[model samples]
Target: MKGTGEEVVSLFYIGTAIMLFLAFGLLFIVVTYQRHFFRMKRKEAENMLKVSLESEKNERARIAADLHDGVSGDLSAIKNYLSVLAKKESENKEIFDEIREGVDAALQNTRAVSHNLMPPLLETEGLVPALKGYLESIGAKAQIYFEVTANGAVALPASVAYQLFRVLQELTTNMVKYGNVSKCDINIALNKEALTIDITDDGTPFNFRENLAKPNASGLKNINSRLHAVGGVIVQEEEKQVGNHFTITLKNVNNA
Candidate 1:
């Protein structure tokens, strides 16, 4: 009887051990599946964002080309015809001049819009020159001075360059239009391991986080999205007392 009872006790212990092992295995499987599912979803989201950005870029280029080649060409033709009409019809010379001025202004505005949409310098000379040209044009109009400094090798993939350019463009535009900026400085640092851009502006003080939290802040959201697409980050330096300072960093430059 004693031996039989001992065998029954041993069987109970063995059963409990098997049951615990099965439970743990089931839990591990569940956890692993969940992780894999989340990872796949995150990857899908990133791919979607990239696709959207690429589509927007292509659309901007198309619109810019249309404006430059189609509308600008038409306006130029009209202006030339008007010039001929002004000389032939001297009695209505003032009328012709007025029309010519309007046409010229329209032409200038169209060209400016086209340039902003897809800067020719960006395609021909690269990011730095494009930025300099953009800032120069803005400064001419707004009297805001910009100082750009580049350090290390600044070569980047075309896609990355476009993203960074757009991000900076938004930030600077916001500063000039809303932050009351006068003087701004941009620093670009790049190496094999990392890429960093520091932008400082003597503008009206504002809270980056608070503004970002606003429901209507689509521009800020776009900036965040662009940075995320390139595996980059933007940090607002709180220690700056006078104005706003922002730093963008991408650690895996090669991978990005």
Candidate 2:
């Protein structure tokens, strides 16, 4: 009887141990699944933020282009009419001269503002010509040597061109603002599948990934968002010998 009771007690202990082990295994699985779910949710939220910012930037660019093409053009025509009036009424010297000077100054100011809003060449000509003109303008302003090379001559969609142009502008602005060193290089190549752009500046080297996560630094974030909107990806790196570099690859949306 004593031996049977001892055997029964040992069996009960073994059963309790097995139940505890199973419970721990179940708890670990639940915790792991919950952690994975939260991680996925966080990534989704970040993507949503990127989409929202890109939409806002696109809207701003559209409005600026419209103002330049519509309002600025009208202002230019009015200035031209004033010029004709001035030419015909040369005898009314004082009034005509005053009108001419004021109108001319106003016209000049309008052109400058329009250029800032959206380069007229971007609308009149194609992307390549517009980019060439931009590079020339930047070169004239700064001491830095800027080089641009385009491999193929394919007409890109206007929206794609505009977004890419803005991206290039951002890169140039950053180079001027932060990259204190001298020279910069820009290269654009297009193939059947994709368009690739590389911008390198001999400036102070900084880790883009580190800077991107910092608070209130919206430039890199904005660039990433714009690239994402256009089905493009941007990679940033700092080389040991070279400076900061950005490589942007845009998928051919028309094909897709």
Tell me each candidate's TM-score: 0.89, 0.68
The list of candidate 1 runs beyond 4 A from truth reads 1-19, 252-255
By summed lDDT, which 10 consecutive residues of candidate 2 come out lowest?
A: 49-58
For residues 1-256, could you state the per-residue lDDT of candidate 2 as single tens digits?
9999999999999999899989998999999999999999977875786567557656665766666677667767777787788788878867867776776777667656657557667767867788878877776787778888888674787767767877787778777777785888888888877888888888888787788899876888777767766779988854656588888898875542
To one decimal, what is the Cα RMSD in angstroms of model 1 from the true structure? 2.3
Best of the candidates, lDDT? 1
Clashing pairs in 2: none
Candidate 1 global CA lDDT score: 0.90
lDDT of 1 by residue, 1-256 (tens): 9999999999999999999999999999999999999999999999999999989989999999999999999999999999999999999999999999999999999999999999988877777888889999987788899888888447777778888899999998898789888999999988767888999999888887888999999999999999999899999998465789999998886676
lDDT of each model, Cα atoms only? 0.90, 0.76
Clashes of each: 0, 0
Location of the lowest summed lDDT over 10 successive residues in candidate 1 = 152-161
